[model samples]
Target: MSTTPLEAGIIPLVDAAPLIIAREIGFAEEEGLDLRLHRAPSWSSLRDMLALGQIDAAHMLSAMPVAMALGLGGFAERIDVLSVLSVNGNVIGCSLDLAARMRAAGYGFDFVDATAAGRALIAAAGDTPRIGVPFPFSMHAELLYHWLGALGVQAPQALRVVTVPPPLMAQAMAAGEIDAFCVGAPWGSTAVEDGVGELLLPTTAIRAFAPEKVLAVRHTWAEAEPDLTRRLMRAVWRAGRWLDQEDNCLTASEILARPDYLNVSSEVVERSLTGRLVISPRGDLRSVPNYLVFFRGAAAYPWRSQAALMAHSLAARSGLDRAAAVKAARSIFRTDLYRQNLRDLGAEMPGATDKVEGAMRDPTAVASEAGHLILEPDAFFDGFIFDPTGDE
Candidate 1:
């Protein structure tokens, strides 16, 4: 079979596993796609590459396409999120000095309680705590804002938000550029490995099902090349499904650790995959089930609600019209295209395109065409449920 060549941009993080796995494990090849994965230096560069048509698609931050639609990132191009590639894979860590201070202040790094962690961090970190995030328009930023704001930190206003690439997070911490960071694994694990920082909490503790990275493409490209878009989405979806299996963790980690990919140790990558993370240099392990989700519980489904929730936060922060921002953001997540492409492949199609974000607190069955779709817990730590339909 003759395959159509396609290039996709990705940052070197463990969450980029689906795209790498698709190419290495023959999913992309089986779908008649010659997928070329490019490792971008940072999320900003990857976003620009997708916007400028340097790549056909990108493993992007879930909030990126929304931010572009709302005219926040200074990029004029319209990008569509084809699917959610990964979810809740971020870790919030702090420098060794701050960790020591928090511990001295009696804050245990429980790695489960977002409220406790946030309050402790606020108290430990000075009046203007510097926090590093992979990108400004990222779930890491959004999660940090929500987590800190709920704990009375006043968020981005009162805090110093620094933009540091994931791979450089440890270095930034060591150089004292940032007192704390919210980054994707295994970079957060890298900080622990390097003994520069210690993991405080996984972002999942803040928002249980935050969409971390997305499979994104130029809106025009997706519209013009429907067949190719469908093939790529299906290929990546299959890769995510494979990665979701418990037995495939070791192999997936090994593949992701290749030099062409993350280039980190396979063991470090495996920690994120298995959700058994070492939180400190002392080898204190924390078992966080579903810490990083690729395909289970409609993890690949790009729900419009997720985009709206992100838009709601972005608009409030950027002084944009909230309702208009949400309206624009919802269209970027292509639920219709998701159904059109993956319906026949035995992929469970959720009956609803939009739901109340942060409403599900447990693995609850929801309406779906297959009638057996149970969504994972997606509650925010503050118990806030965002109704996308009621945005007005």
Candidate 2:
């Protein structure tokens, strides 16, 4: 009886729940991956470890692989992102004053209207608003840029974008070090709960399928250990499915709140998980359900629309050509690996065929009534897997 150790890095956010749960619930062990879960304090810390193969893999941001693939920032290598850990788990939170300014400015504070508020924040802050995001290359920063630019408000050189850990987001908001923050769950909801800030937008408000965290591996490692990568992806997919069960939200929240994981209260975690979001009980915000989702059937699969968006985002940010950026995006966002793992696992699957599109159709439309099982549409997008190296 030999234990095969697979070292993996994780960050302290709910989006990392899939990796943590896969380890804690025996899925990784069953797969013969003796998982050694190490906590990386920040995204850069996690990225460096994965880039250098210090850890075999990491729970990462959806944009990270794209940015790294395009050499957007200081990340030197072309790393590959094998799978998305979770999608649409982020939110935009602002100080009470910032929230008020938004209302006074006549912009609805949901994702669809975030462009207005994001630009308004930049305009109101003028020289600098001292905004906080987890990491520069993470989805938070990319999304901030998209939302701001959508309103014709470029992130001027004067606007400050700082890195703050998810746990510290609440304290920073209370201390007034940051004017607004775009962060993963618990922290954003925690701020409003404590009267330190107000919830501005549920991330789903803008794009329902925004990619949050991903399973990132060194490009070389993925090429060398295809079996290990498949095993890892299967474990993640299983863990994701396990978390999606309606009855499992409470249990999953407990797992995530342990000191070794997210280290947040179960109450704070639940709000994000079940959409019991308390959007300012006494204020103008409204509470909503279906907030945080580990698995929403086909919603969990790594769709290519998200990959293209990441490509476009990295290109826009780094001033790269759009075609080259899309090519970079396809390399890492591989659905073939995902499909192989699904077949090996004998898991019930969505019937997503080779078609690639910006959005996936409702799985319920094609699912057989016997199992109530949802299937991703066959040819869901137009020839989705044509080239893992795109811009075609």
Whole-model lDDT values for every prediction: 0.91, 0.71
Q: Residue by residue across 1-392, what tens digits does model 1's lDDT show? A: 88999999988888888999999999999999999999888778888888999999999989889999999876989999999999998889999999999999999788999999988888988888899998899999998888888888877689788998777888998999999999888888888989999999988899899899999999999999999999999999999999999999889989999888888789989989998999999999999978999998999999999999999999999999998998899998999999999999989999999878999899989999999999999999999889887726
Clashing residue pairs in candidate 1 are: none
lDDT of candidate 2 at residue 383, scale 0 to 100: 22
Where in model 1 is the C-alpha error above 4 Å? none
Task: State candidate 2's TM-score.
Answer: 0.83
lDDT of 2 by residue, 68-109 (tens): 878776667767766777876777888887767767876666
Candidate 2 residue 346 C-alpha distance from true site, Å: 4.2
Give residue 127's lDDT in candidate 1 (0 to 100). 80
